[model samples]
Target: MDVDLVVPGLYCLRPEFGQAYLWLDGRSATLVDTGIVGSGPAITALLTELDADLDRIVITHGHQDHAGSAAELRAATGAPVLAHAGDAAAIRGERPMPPPVLLDWERPLFDSIASNVPPNPPCPVDQEIAEGDVLDFGGGARVLSIPGHTDGSVAIHLPRSEVLFAGDTIANVDELMLGVFNVDRAKAIESFRRLAELGTEIACFGHGDPLIGDAGAKLRAAAAKITG
Candidate 1:
């Protein structure tokens, strides 16, 4: 596991699979997306080093990589877990995750990685969030319901800080591209475009390195090339 500073008060935690972001607000912190299972200890250590208390655990979606350690972390820190209502059941283990509608080219890649991802245990969500809801972190994070990656996928936009936490709607692997493995590709594309319209200076993604400057323009350029 590796932790890197993304901005003044934000840090990105990279584990073996997926990424988790830590946002510091005073002595309290908000964690966005918990890496795959067994990632809890490393994250807890980092928070301890910073002398920060866990304020909340926000799961971008119900995917295992994103919500895997949510239960463990919440249990350890006594922090509330938040997720979109659309995926609440899946996160709570009341239902199965909606399978992605993989494209022909995505088959091999998905098959290769799917087996490596550990199954996420059921986690309880203390808050069910939706579009337009302002979470009390990062100067009020506006929840933009950007579904399609999963029925409940969301992008958290901090208009005050001009930073956007794009869950899996977008990725920056080798470059800025639309995230793959979507249950609804068309809706994901639309959501991508909507996120591009936001005015942001920095964009943190669930994978790859984040765009630190002029992120809005980069997102727009990438969005312009994508078609449903």
Candidate 2:
């Protein structure tokens, strides 16, 4: 329910398992992740608080919790959906993702929820992105590909502000759920090391509260455990 963590223009809506972010650049806002199916009202409330029209909705990955409301939100906002090509199939609900590597206990729970995510009605992708690609919002906000959480995972890195919207490639230290359920444990760790190199000051993850203060130290610590 902690919807607004305003930092100049970034606001966060706490969604279950994963969270969504609203980047207000001007009269329009760039929404990253639409949250789970039961998140429509909370998302709507975020828009109300921002007072900015959702210009475009960006899906960081294809998981249900990250993209559940995409089609519905698009209808309401008339905003285009942008995602990487790799996991587009999963997003469109054509094929469910492979189970997380090394985690057997959580498969049933994930499969159950993923089945209900509802295929996002195959919308033509307005833009297909790859790593290091820059997506502009008139001012300065770029969507950088970090991958690994899924083949198509991405992070919205506002270089000008040194803020990164780390989709699920990496979450906060407290995210026990993902600790037990990552599709590729090694790659996810690699992705985290990659983000660590970016020198991002504030990293807002999809599944937990944003990482604040000396993020480099925290990231390196996480990377060490993985490397070890």
Candidate achieving the largest lDDT: 1
**Which portions of model 2 miss their true places by more than 4 Å?**
104-124, 173-180
125-173 in candidate 1: lDDT tens per residue?
Answer: 9999999999999889999999899999999999999999999999999
Q: Count the backbone clashes (under 3 Å) in each candidate.
A: 0, 0
Rate residue 196 of model 1 by lDDT. Answer: 98
Computed on alpha carbons, the lDDT of every model, listed in order, comes to 0.94, 0.72
lDDT of 2: 0.72
TM-score of each candidate structure, all chains considered together: 0.99, 0.85
Candidate 1 lDDT score relative to the true structure: 0.94
